[model samples]
Target chain A: MTKQRAGLYTALTLLAVLFLIPMIWGVSSAFKARSDIFEYPPRLFPAEPTLENFRAILDGQPFWSWLLVSTLVALVSTAVAVFLCCLAGFGFAKYQFRFKNALFDVLISSLAVPFAVIIVPLFILLAVTGTLNVWFALIVPWVAPAFGIFMMRQYVEQSVPDELLHAARIDGAGEFRIFLSVVLPLLRPAVGALAVWNFLNSYNSFLWPLIVVSDPDQYTLPLGLQALFGAEGRQYDLVLAGSVLAAIPSLIVFFVLRKQLLDGLTAGAVK
Target chain B: MSTVSAQPSWWRRNEVRLAPYLFIGPFYVLYALFMIIPIGAGVYLSFTDWAGLGAPQWIGLENYRYLLQDNSFWTSLGNTVFYMSFTMLVVLPASLLLASALNARGLKLRDTFRIIFFVPVVISPIVVALVFGLIFDGQFGLMNALLQAVFGFGGIEWTTDPLWARVVVVVLVLWRWTGYLTIFFLAGLQNVPRELYEAAALDGAGAVRSFLSVTLPALRPVTAFIGVTVLVSTAQIFEEPFLLTQGGPGESTLSIAMFIYRAAFQRQELGYAAAAGVLMFAAVFTIGRIALRLFQVGRNA
Candidate 1:
């Protein structure tokens, strides 16, 4: 490589390390005692690694319930959202109907509206529907993502050809079956992308869950971790243990679906 | 081959039309129940004073009037603006540079670097809060330890000091978002044709000049997209401050979203919070539009 290109690579290496430092130090500090975390010279590794912090978080609090709630909510919500977006995307892409543009336009506009603006009213709405403290509050709102619909439409329209649908129809296959057997199979990548995206989003969501659910036992992992932080503010090891545990699923999902997720982000992500 | 059984003409026609509606209907229904109705309900509720328990007493814009005069509302708004401006300014350019570096010809081990950077985007803010909360430890934090060891500096009260509390939050936002934005820029960078760079290279244009004349203009739209996202997300920021300080150090780190949440949930000021939410929607909408326009103008220039 040329001199300038070599310099650029070195700089990029430094930035990458700078980015990774927190997680590395987090793992290092997670096993350290509260006092040791405040060591005058920060050590790269814990002096005496212990599982006590993890034990306390897992055993002491309603941590298992939180993890279960988080897992259930993320998966169910993502599935619902992806399936709904697929139906809408297929309809919008395959058929041209009355008020289609207007309806889709409204959904798209709602996407631009800030979630913070709707939180207060949505909380009340969920309460009125008697779904406030239940899993419905988590699953329902996520089931209709405008971005997912848009992406699916783009994917279906571009990839699902006219001849294929026509051929399916000529075989006397029902519209739903044609979509089920043919269209959906073609939309696998977008499905994966939306699944991963929605899962991460639903998993990380804090404000809505924090406001809607008052029950402690139903708290998600994030809320659980926050509760840990709140209860044990100075207990860095314990809090970090909860955090490290909470981070694993998302990290793994991201590593696996990074390509699909990132490509989906760039596709049909116009403002 | 005889599978094309005769159906009634009207039924067939209706099916053709209604099938699309049937497929897409649930989405519209959900959007209405979740988004449109709640938005309308929020606007209506903004005009009344109600806790979750009581019937809403109808008043005319009083909640908004109170929000306008609310000192905490103003403080939260100010802090959000401060955080948004600082992080967006720093992250956008830095991400662009990093994207450019990764996009550079003959770059090796770039995939590893990309993953390292992008990991933060997927990690929850609460986890980010946990990790950084330890780092910002007042006595023996990695930050302070480094300060003491390298420069013989004493510990700084990062979370407790109001100014430093804001600083910590800004740094956290920067760390979490910069890599996320970098990927967008990288995607943008990949779209630029190599021939443009080659053509410029032959015209006696240096790398720096070629980048400004070629790469910068090409990535303008991605920059705008990132900018608007930053504006919208930062305006709604809650977890960072809520986790790090619980809007403490005299509420210096409180974002507008945090303020709205505390109002609605903690204080039972539902109407006030809804009105504040309306204001936030308007603020984000208007500012985002103006910023997009500015970006447009910059691109055209």
Candidate 2:
């Protein structure tokens, strides 16, 4: 039994090390001066450890602007999605209106539709509406996440009792008032989970934003990073630095909301 | 009962009851406009020869017929399938193995490991591709540089060489996805009843034997979900290959999604591209159904 326990510990440690490789590489590579990045045997530590890559990415590119775009879009979209999905999730979970099951089925099945398949039509829609250059194009499509609604529905159904809702209603609470005061408070944990999911999904969004926004100033961090891939001139260190920049927000969110995030992901599988 | 008046009529009496729909109305309307209408449009556009701006010329069944002979489309389809299969073969086992290890008792800094593993999934694809592109760079890449130093061998041309390019793509997919799948499997592992393991051990089942007989079988549903999702998502792989290889090294790494995008946007053949997408979607759906059924049967057996 002691031997078995030792074996498991050894295995887990090795797995953990393997997982840390890329991230370690990302940060270490960022500190390497441009010239040292492609050095033979790839020294794990840079001798000079210059922040040239970071400096170049920051000063040369509109890195701050792009980061701002990403933050605004991720935050605003997450907020909108959480608000809308909570109401929808609560309605589906608590109330039995006409065609409730059918509507939800449609919503869930819509999950299979990949964004790549819809990019062109969305582009066309935005183009016709003359909202092409506007930030609305970047924000709107992500604001109504079906998965968020689905997860929120599941969480609310299992956790929030209908008796509580009825009591609140019996006390002459308006429907919206009941939702805001009663339902939203109980949904805090699920809301935290959904917030992280929506933020990451919105922040990491690629295809739609790639096609919709043509202007550099309008570019999100992901799109801006893709723009760096242009030209034959390869500044690998700078690219890695930029990638590290792109990854930090989502990584931070995952850490801070780790429990909720795990629950959100596992919710589907465990169900 | 005395206080209860006539039940509120569906429309007038319960107009306030419609608040949920009112809250949720925006999403459905947007989905209908951006998602539903486009899908319908995509299906229609597939039959017609629509370029981006100009009026679409009706070419019923012709685009599909052309796709039947389009060698590049077939090649792209084949490549995507190959990539997906390779990812499943390599990454699936790795994920399960890692999850098992992580589930082991008294692991140090396990949460830290989970976060690190999940970093790839959270990072933008463009960043992943960019870093990978540097690593796979033919001459200046760290991969080749290391190969030269350690093994006294010349670096393989990763992006420019056809076979190597495909290998790099598979490797990228593995790197990006392995952690995501591991987390799912870990979750699945957590829900597994601990008593089953104790019972298996008491029956004199070795670790390997017990895992094979018990844990693997128990994880069948999550396995099925992961398998179908991974395959479908792999089939639609775009940004990684788009950024890394740009479907180059002689079109060896061109995914069906990339093919569709190229045909539609780059070549301005929206009709043909839509047809290709529809075909790809059908292929994915059919495979997903088969995989799901097989998983169910395997579980039952």
DockQ of each: 0.57, 0.47
How big is the positional error of residue B59 in model 2, measured in Å on the Cα after superposition?
A: 1.7
lDDT of each: 0.82, 0.79
The lowest-lDDT stretch of 10 consecutive residues in candidate 2 chain B is: B292-301
| Model 1 RMSD vs true structure | 3.0
Q: What does the lDDT read for residue A56 in candidate 1?
A: 87
Model 2 docking grade: acceptable
Could you tell me which residue pairs clash in candidate 2?
Answer: none
Tens-place lDDT digits, model 2, residues B1-301: 5677876557645745686677667768978977888777778888898777768899899999999998898888898888887878989999998888888766677777777777778878887777777677787777787788888886799999999998888888888888889888998898889999999999999999999998998888788778767777787888778888989877888988899888877898888888887787667766765775566421223
Q: Model 1: runs farther than 4 Å from truth?
A: B1-5, B8-11, B287-301
Candidate 1 has a TM-score of 0.93
What digit string (tens of lDDT, one per residue) describes model 1 on residues A129-235?
77776688888777888778877886787688999999998887778888899899998888888899899999998877887677888889888777767773456
User: What's the residue-level lDDT of B247 in candidate 1?
Assistant: 90
